[model samples]
Target: MKELNIAVVGATGAVGQEILKVIEERKVPFKSLRMLASSRSAGKEITFMEKTYTVEETTLDAFKGVDVALFAGGPASRAFGRDVQAAGTVVIDNSSTFRLEEDVPLIIPEVNGEAAKNHKGLIASPNCSTTLLVGAINPLHQKAGVKRIIVSTYQAVSGAGAAGLTELEDQSRQILDHKPIHLDVFQHQIAFNLIPHIDVWQEEDYSKEETKVLHETHKILDAPDMAITVTAVRVPVMRSHAESVYVEFENPLSPDEAREILAAAPRVVLQDKPHDNIYPMPITATGSDDIYVGRIRKDLYNDHALNLWACFDQIRKGAATNTVQILELLLEKDWI
Candidate 1:
């Protein structure tokens, strides 16, 4: 492999740190690595791969000489994405700002990796829930021709970032002490609670998190007209995300057969053994790179329908690892 110049924007954030870890753990050959964050976080130093690097303030010029830039920032990602691409760097972004754009290809490499070759200097990683959802569903779609999907996500509070985690911990302590719970990171007290809302409401009263699943799945699978409905919820869990997915296929797909296919699917770890109470859980999937899938069973009403339960590290595979996978695809194809 050739050594390339790589940079990670928003290096101080959760997903950004994971991106660095993935690159290090995968032993990606890089001639140079740069870390950039906001001015507030600039000057911070991180030790990775036994080497220390300082985080610089992100700017248009920071992308200079970079071959591939992984972005794990917020809406600010759009600004840096344009700058990075203008500097001749390919940006693999982990934000919603670019996913719906016509020119940017929304990718889950395992499903539509070829789409990376179609990028106009930028590519998008899907939302966390969508990432895990597609990983477990794509194989079945290819085999049975999926017609409809109904999914409900149990997303961890960490999805809201560091503040969310702190808030949950504080709330738990407050509740245990019989004190008033605080609600800083969420609309309601997240400790020992579930918030059905994940993002701002949009058309038809569906949350942004819910709608992203519908659109991104279609684009990734090349099934623009497929029916996909999702409900995104924020739970008090610290890490990882879990989902209950119901899939209706065009062809007959039995539970046993679905289990067989999912077991052999790439990046999916099968744990379906209901009799022994073994199944995928957020706690078990906290640091996993693969999607843990189980609870396989046929829907009583439809012979072509099956229900699945899946869990995965929301920060790793969903954001950072997938972005790295895109870079790997570009590298393998010599696109970057």
Candidate 2:
């Protein structure tokens, strides 16, 4: 494969930083690198591959001569996506802004790699929680035919971006100092409390994050009619995100069979041993690239339903690594 010149938009943000880390850790073959951010962050230096590169203001022209552009920023993609594509750069966006569009492919390479082949210069990464959950569930669903999914998320502050993590840390420090706690990024204090809300509330009372889980899961799995209900909650943890998933399949599957299936799934690690106290935990999963799943058992109330727990580094596998993996696939297929 030929070395490509890559541009990383929103390089100053948490996910963007993780993208750089993954690129370095995996030794992605990039002939050149450019960092782009907002004017406020311009001129800030970010170190990658042992050298410092200053961030420049992101503009349409910034994509010039770039072979691939990774947009980890927010809705700013709307303002610059066309320009990036017009400049002949294939964009892999990590924002929700474009995932649902019919023209753009919402992708998880392991689940639907062929979707990447149809990209019209842009591809989207699914929600962090949705990505991890589907990474584990898709394999099993393919094997046993999933009929329904009931998931409750225990998401980390990092999913809310850097400000979310800072709010949690600062609130904790204030509580430790016996000072008044200030809540900003979230409706309630996230230092020691769990907010049963993520993103905005919709008319049906489900949060945007919950809706993303429902919608993105179907889009990626191509199972639009699949029954899914989600409750997304923000926890005090700084990194990994966890999920309690209850799934009902078309066919009955044993705990051993479930483990055997999940164990062989791509980017999925089965850690289900209750007697040894071995299971997926946020602490153990943080900084790792695979989704860890455990607590496999048949649901007592429903014969075909199974309950499981899953965890993954929200920044890595959920955001950065998934994006990088998509890029790797693009390279392998000569899409870029």
> How much is 230 displaced in model 2, in angstroms?
0.5
Per-residue alpha-carbon lDDT of model 1 for 1-336, expressed as tens digits?
778999999899888888998998888889999998899999999998989999999898888888888898586597778777877988889988888888999998778888888678999999888899899998999999999999999999878876777898999999999999877879988898889998899999999999999998888888998999999999889888999999999999988888889899888999999899999998888877899999998999999899989999988888889889888888888877
lDDT of 1 at 245: 90
RMSD of each: 1.1, 1.0
User: What TM-score, computed on C-alpha atoms, does each candidate reach?
Assistant: 0.97, 0.98
Report residue 49 deviation for candidate 2 (angstroms): 1.0
- What ranges in model 2 sit over 4 Å off? none
Error of 1 at 47 (Å): 1.1
In terms of lDDT, the best-performing candidate is 2
Q: Per-model C-alpha lDDT, please?
A: 0.89, 0.91
Give the 10-residue window scoring lowest on summed lDDT in candidate 2. 73-82
Q: Which stretches of candidate 1 lie over 4 Å from their true place?
A: none
